[model samples]
Target: MCGRFSLYSSYSTLSQGLKLPLEVAVKLTPRYNVAPGTWITAVRHPTDNEPLVMDEVWWGYRPHWAKEKAPEPINATVEKVATSNYFRGAFAHHRCLVPADGWYEWLPLNGKKQPHFLCREDREPIWLAAIWTERPDGKPGCAILTEPARGVAKEIHPRMPLALDAESLKPWLDPHLTDRETIRQVVHHLDAELITHWPVSTRVNRPTNDEASLIEPLKP
Candidate 1:
Protein backbone atom coordinates (compact mmCIF):
# COMPACT_ATOMS: atom_id res chain seq x y z
CA MET A 1 0.00 0.00 0.00
CA CYS A 2 1.32 3.47 -0.92
CA GLY A 3 0.50 5.21 2.35
CA ARG A 4 3.19 7.87 2.03
CA PHE A 5 4.96 9.44 -0.96
CA SER A 6 6.83 12.52 -2.21
CA LEU A 7 6.20 15.07 -4.96
CA TYR A 8 8.79 17.83 -4.79
CA SER A 9 9.25 18.16 -8.54
CA SER A 10 8.46 21.59 -10.02
CA TYR A 11 5.32 22.38 -12.02
CA SER A 12 7.39 22.97 -15.15
CA THR A 13 9.05 19.56 -14.81
CA LEU A 14 5.75 17.80 -14.23
CA SER A 15 4.17 19.64 -17.16
CA GLN A 16 6.98 18.64 -19.49
CA GLY A 17 7.03 15.05 -18.23
CA LEU A 18 3.30 14.43 -18.32
CA LYS A 19 2.82 16.57 -21.43
CA LEU A 20 -0.21 18.32 -19.93
CA PRO A 21 -0.63 22.02 -19.34
CA LEU A 22 -1.09 21.94 -15.57
CA GLU A 23 -3.28 24.70 -14.18
CA VAL A 24 -1.38 27.11 -11.97
CA ALA A 25 -4.45 27.80 -9.82
CA VAL A 26 -3.24 25.21 -7.33
CA LYS A 27 0.06 26.41 -6.01
CA LEU A 28 2.78 23.79 -6.23
CA THR A 29 5.11 23.10 -3.34
CA PRO A 30 7.94 20.76 -2.53
CA ARG A 31 6.15 18.02 -0.60
CA TYR A 32 8.68 15.42 0.55
CA ASN A 33 6.19 13.63 2.73
CA VAL A 34 2.60 13.42 1.45
CA ALA A 35 -0.01 11.59 3.52
CA PRO A 36 -3.55 10.52 2.85
CA GLY A 37 -6.74 12.54 3.53
CA THR A 38 -4.95 15.66 2.30
CA TRP A 39 -5.25 17.48 -1.01
CA ILE A 40 -2.92 16.07 -3.73
CA THR A 41 -2.40 16.81 -7.39
CA ALA A 42 -4.09 14.65 -10.03
CA VAL A 43 -4.67 14.79 -13.79
CA ARG A 44 -8.14 13.98 -15.10
CA HIS A 45 -10.34 14.20 -18.15
CA PRO A 46 -13.47 15.94 -16.89
CA THR A 47 -15.49 15.29 -20.03
CA ASP A 48 -15.39 13.22 -23.20
CA ASN A 49 -14.03 16.03 -25.35
CA GLU A 50 -12.24 18.16 -22.82
CA PRO A 51 -8.46 18.23 -22.50
CA LEU A 52 -6.96 16.65 -19.40
CA VAL A 53 -6.89 18.98 -16.41
CA MET A 54 -4.51 18.93 -13.45
CA ASP A 55 -6.06 19.84 -10.10
CA GLU A 56 -5.91 19.18 -6.41
CA VAL A 57 -8.13 16.43 -5.04
CA TRP A 58 -8.64 14.93 -1.62
CA TRP A 59 -6.58 11.74 -1.29
CA GLY A 60 -9.47 9.66 -0.07
CA TYR A 61 -12.44 8.31 -1.98
CA ARG A 62 -16.13 8.17 -1.11
CA PRO A 63 -18.68 8.47 -3.85
CA HIS A 64 -21.27 11.19 -3.48
CA TRP A 65 -24.05 8.58 -3.29
CA ALA A 66 -22.32 6.46 -0.71
CA LYS A 67 -23.58 6.52 2.85
CA GLU A 68 -21.94 9.19 4.97
CA LYS A 69 -20.51 6.44 7.12
CA ALA A 70 -18.97 4.49 4.25
CA PRO A 71 -15.26 3.90 4.51
CA GLU A 72 -13.06 6.32 2.54
CA PRO A 73 -10.21 4.15 1.34
CA ILE A 74 -6.96 5.74 0.17
CA ASN A 75 -5.88 2.75 -1.92
CA ALA A 76 -7.97 0.38 -4.02
CA THR A 77 -6.65 -3.03 -5.10
CA VAL A 78 -6.47 -3.56 -8.86
CA GLU A 79 -7.69 -7.15 -8.50
CA LYS A 80 -11.13 -6.07 -7.32
CA VAL A 81 -11.51 -2.44 -8.35
CA ALA A 82 -13.00 -3.41 -11.70
CA THR A 83 -15.82 -5.40 -10.12
CA SER A 84 -16.18 -4.15 -6.56
CA ASN A 85 -19.52 -2.48 -6.04
CA TYR A 86 -17.97 0.40 -4.11
CA PHE A 87 -15.30 1.17 -6.73
CA ARG A 88 -16.40 -0.11 -10.14
CA GLY A 89 -18.24 3.06 -11.08
CA ALA A 90 -15.27 5.33 -10.63
CA PHE A 91 -12.87 2.73 -12.01
CA ALA A 92 -14.81 2.62 -15.22
CA HIS A 93 -15.56 6.30 -15.64
CA HIS A 94 -13.19 8.44 -13.62
CA ARG A 95 -9.67 7.10 -13.95
CA CYS A 96 -6.94 9.66 -13.22
CA LEU A 97 -3.20 9.90 -12.51
CA VAL A 98 -1.34 10.82 -9.30
CA PRO A 99 2.18 12.05 -9.98
CA ALA A 100 4.89 11.38 -7.46
CA ASP A 101 8.67 11.52 -7.25
CA GLY A 102 8.57 8.26 -5.32
CA TRP A 103 6.64 6.35 -2.62
CA TYR A 104 7.44 4.86 0.79
CA GLU A 105 6.85 1.31 1.93
CA TRP A 106 7.88 -0.23 5.23
CA LEU A 107 9.74 -3.50 5.73
CA PRO A 108 9.69 -5.37 9.00
CA LEU A 109 13.16 -5.49 10.51
CA ASN A 110 14.01 -6.88 13.97
CA GLY A 111 10.45 -6.24 15.18
CA LYS A 112 10.56 -2.70 13.74
CA LYS A 113 9.39 -1.35 10.40
CA GLN A 114 12.07 0.28 8.26
CA PRO A 115 10.76 2.75 5.66
CA HIS A 116 12.09 2.65 2.12
CA PHE A 117 11.69 5.06 -0.80
CA LEU A 118 10.93 3.54 -4.22
CA CYS A 119 11.31 5.35 -7.54
CA ARG A 120 12.42 4.97 -11.13
CA GLU A 121 16.14 4.55 -11.57
CA ASP A 122 16.11 7.48 -13.99
CA ARG A 123 14.72 9.76 -11.25
CA GLU A 124 11.77 10.78 -13.42
CA PRO A 125 8.33 11.27 -11.89
CA ILE A 126 5.97 8.32 -11.61
CA TRP A 127 2.31 8.44 -12.63
CA LEU A 128 0.17 6.33 -10.31
CA ALA A 129 -3.14 5.14 -11.75
CA ALA A 130 -6.15 6.22 -9.71
CA ILE A 131 -9.89 6.86 -9.74
CA TRP A 132 -11.90 9.70 -8.28
CA THR A 133 -15.45 10.90 -7.63
CA GLU A 134 -17.18 13.87 -6.03
CA ARG A 135 -17.71 13.28 -2.34
CA PRO A 136 -20.89 14.17 -0.49
CA ASP A 137 -19.33 17.49 0.43
CA GLY A 138 -18.87 18.24 -3.30
CA LYS A 139 -15.10 17.90 -3.18
CA PRO A 140 -13.28 15.55 -5.53
CA GLY A 141 -11.71 12.59 -3.74
CA CYS A 142 -9.48 9.85 -5.16
CA ALA A 143 -8.04 6.43 -4.37
CA ILE A 144 -4.75 5.30 -5.87
CA LEU A 145 -4.81 1.86 -7.45
CA THR A 146 -2.46 -0.84 -6.17
CA GLU A 147 -1.31 -4.16 -7.56
CA PRO A 148 0.99 -6.99 -6.50
CA ALA A 149 4.47 -5.62 -6.07
CA ARG A 150 7.09 -6.62 -8.60
CA GLY A 151 10.91 -6.61 -8.68
CA VAL A 152 12.55 -4.66 -5.86
CA ALA A 153 9.23 -3.36 -4.54
CA LYS A 154 8.15 -6.91 -3.72
CA GLU A 155 11.10 -7.26 -1.35
CA ILE A 156 9.75 -4.44 0.85
CA HIS A 157 6.02 -5.11 0.62
CA PRO A 158 3.57 -7.40 -1.14
CA ARG A 159 1.90 -4.52 -2.98
CA MET A 160 2.75 -1.18 -4.53
CA PRO A 161 0.99 1.69 -6.32
CA LEU A 162 0.17 0.99 -9.96
CA ALA A 163 2.50 3.40 -11.72
CA LEU A 164 1.66 3.71 -15.37
CA ASP A 165 4.00 3.82 -18.36
CA ALA A 166 4.18 7.11 -20.26
CA GLU A 167 2.35 5.61 -23.21
CA SER A 168 -0.58 4.56 -21.09
CA LEU A 169 -1.25 7.87 -19.32
CA LYS A 170 -3.53 9.44 -21.92
CA PRO A 171 -5.45 6.22 -22.55
CA TRP A 172 -5.90 5.62 -18.84
CA LEU A 173 -7.39 9.10 -18.46
CA ASP A 174 -9.56 8.95 -21.57
CA PRO A 175 -13.12 9.56 -20.32
CA HIS A 176 -14.62 7.56 -23.18
CA LEU A 177 -12.56 4.42 -22.52
CA THR A 178 -14.93 2.82 -20.06
CA ASP A 179 -14.86 -0.83 -21.08
CA ARG A 180 -12.92 -2.81 -18.53
CA GLU A 181 -11.37 -5.28 -20.96
CA THR A 182 -10.32 -2.58 -23.41
CA ILE A 183 -8.78 -0.57 -20.60
CA ARG A 184 -6.86 -3.62 -19.48
CA GLN A 185 -5.58 -4.08 -23.00
CA VAL A 186 -4.59 -0.49 -23.67
CA VAL A 187 -3.13 0.43 -20.29
CA HIS A 188 -0.02 -1.04 -18.66
CA HIS A 189 2.15 -0.47 -15.62
CA LEU A 190 5.65 0.95 -15.79
CA ASP A 191 8.40 -1.62 -16.06
CA ALA A 192 9.31 -2.92 -12.66
CA GLU A 193 12.94 -3.08 -13.77
CA LEU A 194 12.97 0.73 -13.83
CA ILE A 195 12.18 0.90 -10.11
CA THR A 196 14.81 1.16 -7.39
CA HIS A 197 14.57 1.50 -3.61
CA TRP A 198 16.64 2.50 -0.60
CA PRO A 199 15.98 2.63 3.14
CA VAL A 200 15.35 6.18 4.35
CA SER A 201 15.29 7.96 7.70
CA THR A 202 12.45 6.92 9.99
CA ARG A 203 11.69 10.66 10.35
CA VAL A 204 9.34 10.02 7.42
CA ASN A 205 7.19 7.83 9.66
CA ARG A 206 5.69 11.04 11.04
CA PRO A 207 3.63 12.88 8.44
CA THR A 208 4.58 16.26 9.85
CA ASN A 209 8.30 15.54 9.44
CA ASP A 210 8.46 16.81 5.88
CA GLU A 211 11.80 17.90 4.43
CA ALA A 212 14.51 17.00 1.91
CA SER A 213 16.47 15.02 4.49
CA LEU A 214 13.54 12.64 4.89
CA ILE A 215 14.42 11.04 1.55
CA GLU A 216 18.18 10.83 2.17
CA PRO A 217 19.57 7.30 2.30
CA LEU A 218 19.77 6.10 5.88
CA LYS A 219 23.44 5.79 6.81
CA PRO A 220 24.78 2.29 7.45
Candidate 2:
Protein backbone atom coordinates (compact mmCIF):
# COMPACT_ATOMS: atom_id res chain seq x y z
CA MET A 1 0.00 0.00 0.00
CA CYS A 2 3.01 2.32 0.19
CA GLY A 3 2.63 3.33 -3.47
CA ARG A 4 4.52 6.58 -2.89
CA PHE A 5 7.12 7.77 -0.43
CA SER A 6 9.74 10.47 0.07
CA LEU A 7 13.45 10.74 0.76
CA TYR A 8 14.42 14.30 1.62
CA SER A 9 17.70 13.47 3.28
CA SER A 10 21.06 14.20 1.68
CA TYR A 11 23.34 11.43 0.44
CA SER A 12 25.73 11.72 3.34
CA THR A 13 22.89 11.76 5.84
CA LEU A 14 21.51 8.58 4.34
CA SER A 15 24.96 7.04 4.13
CA GLN A 16 25.68 7.78 7.78
CA GLY A 17 22.23 6.71 8.96
CA LEU A 18 22.37 3.41 7.09
CA LYS A 19 26.11 2.86 7.60
CA LEU A 20 26.97 2.27 4.00
CA PRO A 21 30.02 2.35 1.76
CA LEU A 22 30.39 5.29 -0.62
CA GLU A 23 29.61 4.68 -4.28
CA VAL A 24 28.75 6.73 -7.35
CA ALA A 25 25.17 7.80 -6.76
CA VAL A 26 22.51 8.95 -9.18
CA LYS A 27 21.50 12.35 -7.93
CA LEU A 28 18.63 11.97 -5.42
CA THR A 29 16.75 15.22 -5.58
CA PRO A 30 13.59 15.54 -3.52
CA ARG A 31 10.80 13.46 -5.03
CA TYR A 32 7.03 13.45 -4.58
CA ASN A 33 6.10 10.83 -7.17
CA VAL A 34 8.35 7.90 -6.44
CA ALA A 35 6.19 5.27 -8.13
CA PRO A 36 7.10 1.81 -9.33
CA GLY A 37 9.79 1.17 -11.96
CA THR A 38 12.17 3.84 -10.68
CA TRP A 39 15.62 3.18 -9.25
CA ILE A 40 15.82 3.36 -5.44
CA THR A 41 18.34 2.87 -2.68
CA ALA A 42 18.41 -0.13 -0.32
CA VAL A 43 20.65 -1.04 2.60
CA ARG A 44 21.83 -4.56 3.34
CA HIS A 45 23.90 -6.32 5.98
CA PRO A 46 25.88 -9.10 4.33
CA THR A 47 27.58 -10.41 7.48
CA ASP A 48 27.45 -9.76 11.19
CA ASN A 49 30.94 -8.32 11.10
CA GLU A 50 30.56 -6.15 8.01
CA PRO A 51 29.05 -2.67 8.00
CA LEU A 52 25.62 -2.12 6.47
CA VAL A 53 25.84 -0.97 2.87
CA MET A 54 23.46 1.17 0.81
CA ASP A 55 23.13 0.91 -2.95
CA GLU A 56 20.66 1.84 -5.63
CA VAL A 57 18.29 -0.67 -7.22
CA TRP A 58 15.07 -0.61 -9.20
CA TRP A 59 11.84 -0.52 -7.22
CA GLY A 60 10.05 -3.54 -8.63
CA TYR A 61 10.28 -7.34 -8.77
CA ARG A 62 10.41 -9.54 -11.86
CA PRO A 63 10.47 -13.23 -10.97
CA HIS A 64 12.55 -15.51 -13.15
CA TRP A 65 9.52 -17.74 -13.70
CA ALA A 66 7.27 -15.06 -15.12
CA LYS A 67 6.74 -15.54 -18.85
CA GLU A 68 5.03 -12.18 -19.24
CA LYS A 69 6.91 -9.17 -20.53
CA ALA A 70 6.42 -7.20 -17.32
CA PRO A 71 9.64 -7.21 -15.32
CA GLU A 72 8.77 -5.28 -12.23
CA PRO A 73 6.17 -6.09 -9.63
CA ILE A 74 6.06 -3.16 -7.22
CA ASN A 75 4.62 -4.97 -4.23
CA ALA A 76 5.18 -8.33 -2.53
CA THR A 77 3.12 -9.97 0.17
CA VAL A 78 5.13 -11.05 3.21
CA GLU A 79 2.73 -13.85 4.14
CA LYS A 80 3.23 -15.74 0.90
CA VAL A 81 6.74 -14.65 -0.15
CA ALA A 82 8.48 -17.30 1.90
CA THR A 83 6.38 -20.13 0.44
CA SER A 84 5.77 -18.84 -3.08
CA ASN A 85 8.29 -20.10 -5.59
CA TYR A 86 8.24 -16.77 -7.43
CA PHE A 87 9.50 -15.03 -4.31
CA ARG A 88 11.20 -17.75 -2.27
CA GLY A 89 14.35 -17.66 -4.36
CA ALA A 90 14.72 -13.91 -4.06
CA PHE A 91 13.73 -14.07 -0.40
CA ALA A 92 16.76 -16.20 0.25
CA HIS A 93 19.19 -14.32 -1.96
CA HIS A 94 18.02 -10.73 -2.26
CA ARG A 95 16.83 -9.24 1.02
CA CYS A 96 17.05 -5.41 1.24
CA LEU A 97 15.89 -2.26 3.03
CA VAL A 98 13.77 0.53 1.44
CA PRO A 99 14.61 3.66 3.43
CA ALA A 100 12.12 6.50 3.57
CA ASP A 101 11.36 9.67 5.47
CA GLY A 102 7.69 8.64 5.26
CA TRP A 103 5.02 7.09 3.01
CA TYR A 104 1.71 8.02 1.39
CA GLU A 105 -1.60 6.14 1.21
CA TRP A 106 -4.94 7.21 -0.20
CA LEU A 107 -8.49 7.32 1.11
CA PRO A 108 -11.26 6.58 -1.35
CA LEU A 109 -13.42 9.59 -2.03
CA ASN A 110 -16.04 10.56 -4.63
CA GLY A 111 -14.60 8.59 -7.52
CA LYS A 112 -11.13 9.72 -6.51
CA LYS A 113 -8.46 8.73 -4.02
CA GLN A 114 -7.36 11.38 -1.53
CA PRO A 115 -3.82 11.03 -0.25
CA HIS A 116 -2.64 11.10 3.34
CA PHE A 117 0.96 11.53 4.49
CA LEU A 118 2.37 9.43 7.32
CA CYS A 119 5.57 9.99 9.26
CA ARG A 120 7.31 9.12 12.49
CA GLU A 121 7.06 11.77 15.18
CA ASP A 122 10.81 11.51 15.52
CA ARG A 123 11.12 12.99 12.01
CA GLU A 124 13.68 10.35 11.34
CA PRO A 125 14.03 8.11 8.30
CA ILE A 126 12.52 4.61 8.40
CA TRP A 127 13.66 1.43 6.77
CA LEU A 128 11.01 -0.65 4.99
CA ALA A 129 11.34 -4.44 4.80
CA ALA A 130 12.15 -5.07 1.13
CA ILE A 131 13.15 -7.93 -1.21
CA TRP A 132 15.24 -7.58 -4.35
CA THR A 133 16.77 -9.21 -7.46
CA GLU A 134 19.93 -8.84 -9.57
CA ARG A 135 20.02 -9.65 -13.26
CA PRO A 136 23.21 -10.65 -15.01
CA ASP A 137 22.81 -7.66 -17.39
CA GLY A 138 20.38 -5.29 -15.65
CA LYS A 139 20.15 -3.04 -12.67
CA PRO A 140 19.16 -4.74 -9.40
CA GLY A 141 15.42 -4.51 -8.72
CA CYS A 142 13.35 -4.66 -5.49
CA ALA A 143 9.84 -4.79 -4.08
CA ILE A 144 8.37 -3.42 -0.88
CA LEU A 145 6.58 -6.11 1.13
CA THR A 146 3.23 -5.47 2.80
CA GLU A 147 1.42 -6.60 5.95
CA PRO A 148 -1.99 -5.86 7.44
CA ALA A 149 -2.17 -2.19 8.33
CA ARG A 150 -2.40 -1.04 11.90
CA GLY A 151 -2.26 2.27 13.76
CA VAL A 152 -2.63 5.36 11.54
CA ALA A 153 -1.87 3.47 8.34
CA LYS A 154 -5.04 1.44 8.77
CA GLU A 155 -7.12 4.56 8.33
CA ILE A 156 -5.98 4.95 4.72
CA HIS A 157 -5.00 1.56 3.37
CA PRO A 158 -5.98 -2.01 4.20
CA ARG A 159 -2.37 -3.13 3.89
CA MET A 160 0.81 -1.20 4.58
CA PRO A 161 4.50 -1.71 3.90
CA LEU A 162 6.31 -4.19 6.16
CA ALA A 163 8.77 -2.05 8.12
CA LEU A 164 11.63 -3.31 10.29
CA ASP A 165 14.24 -2.14 12.78
CA ALA A 166 17.86 -3.06 13.46
CA GLU A 167 16.97 -6.10 15.57
CA SER A 168 14.27 -7.61 13.33
CA LEU A 169 16.01 -6.56 10.11
CA LYS A 170 19.13 -8.60 10.92
CA PRO A 171 17.23 -11.89 10.99
CA TRP A 172 15.20 -11.03 7.90
CA LEU A 173 18.30 -10.38 5.82
CA ASP A 174 20.38 -13.36 6.99
CA PRO A 175 20.04 -16.00 4.28
CA HIS A 176 21.50 -18.80 6.39
CA LEU A 177 18.84 -18.27 9.05
CA THR A 178 15.94 -19.19 6.79
CA ASP A 179 13.72 -21.21 9.09
CA ARG A 180 10.00 -21.11 9.74
CA GLU A 181 10.42 -20.02 13.34
CA THR A 182 12.79 -17.15 12.59
CA ILE A 183 10.82 -15.73 9.68
CA ARG A 184 7.67 -16.11 11.75
CA GLN A 185 8.98 -13.99 14.59
CA VAL A 186 10.18 -11.20 12.29
CA VAL A 187 7.22 -11.16 9.89
CA HIS A 188 4.33 -11.53 12.32
CA HIS A 189 5.37 -8.89 14.85
CA LEU A 190 5.71 -5.17 13.85
CA ASP A 191 6.03 -1.67 15.22
CA ALA A 192 3.19 0.68 14.25
CA GLU A 193 3.33 3.17 17.09
CA LEU A 194 6.25 5.02 15.51
CA ILE A 195 3.92 6.54 12.89
CA THR A 196 1.47 9.45 12.69
CA HIS A 197 -0.77 10.65 9.84
CA TRP A 198 -2.28 13.83 8.41
CA PRO A 199 -4.70 14.65 5.62
CA VAL A 200 -2.96 16.45 2.79
CA SER A 201 -3.91 18.40 -0.33
CA THR A 202 -5.14 16.44 -3.30
CA ARG A 203 -2.12 17.67 -5.28
CA VAL A 204 -0.43 14.43 -4.26
CA ASN A 205 -2.84 12.51 -6.47
CA ARG A 206 -1.05 13.66 -9.57
CA PRO A 207 2.13 11.84 -10.42
CA THR A 208 3.70 14.97 -11.94
CA ASN A 209 3.53 17.18 -8.86
CA ASP A 210 6.75 17.04 -6.85
CA GLU A 211 6.30 19.99 -4.53
CA ALA A 212 6.50 20.13 -0.75
CA SER A 213 2.92 21.33 -0.45
CA LEU A 214 1.66 17.85 -1.25
CA ILE A 215 2.40 16.81 2.32
CA GLU A 216 1.16 19.94 3.98
CA PRO A 217 -1.83 19.46 6.31
CA LEU A 218 -5.20 20.37 4.89
CA LYS A 219 -6.93 23.12 6.81
CA PRO A 220 -10.45 22.54 8.13
Model 2 agreement with the true structure over 144-194: per-residue lDDT tens digits:
988889887888899988877655756666656657566776643346888
lDDT of 2: 0.74
Q: Which pairs clash in the backbone of model 1?
A: none
Model 1 residue 64 CA deviation in Å: 0.8
CA lDDT scores, all candidates in order: 0.92, 0.74
Clashes of 1: 0
- Report lDDT (Cα) of residue 196, candidate 1: 98
- Backbone Cα, N, C clashes tallied per candidate: 0, 0
32-149 per-residue lDDT for model 1 (tens digits): 9999989999998765576678889999999999997999999999999999999999998899999999999999999999999999999999999999998999989999999999
Q: Show model 2 residue runs off by greater than 4 Å.
A: 15-27, 45-52, 135-137, 186-190
- Superposed Cα deviation of residue 59, candidate 2 (Å): 1.5
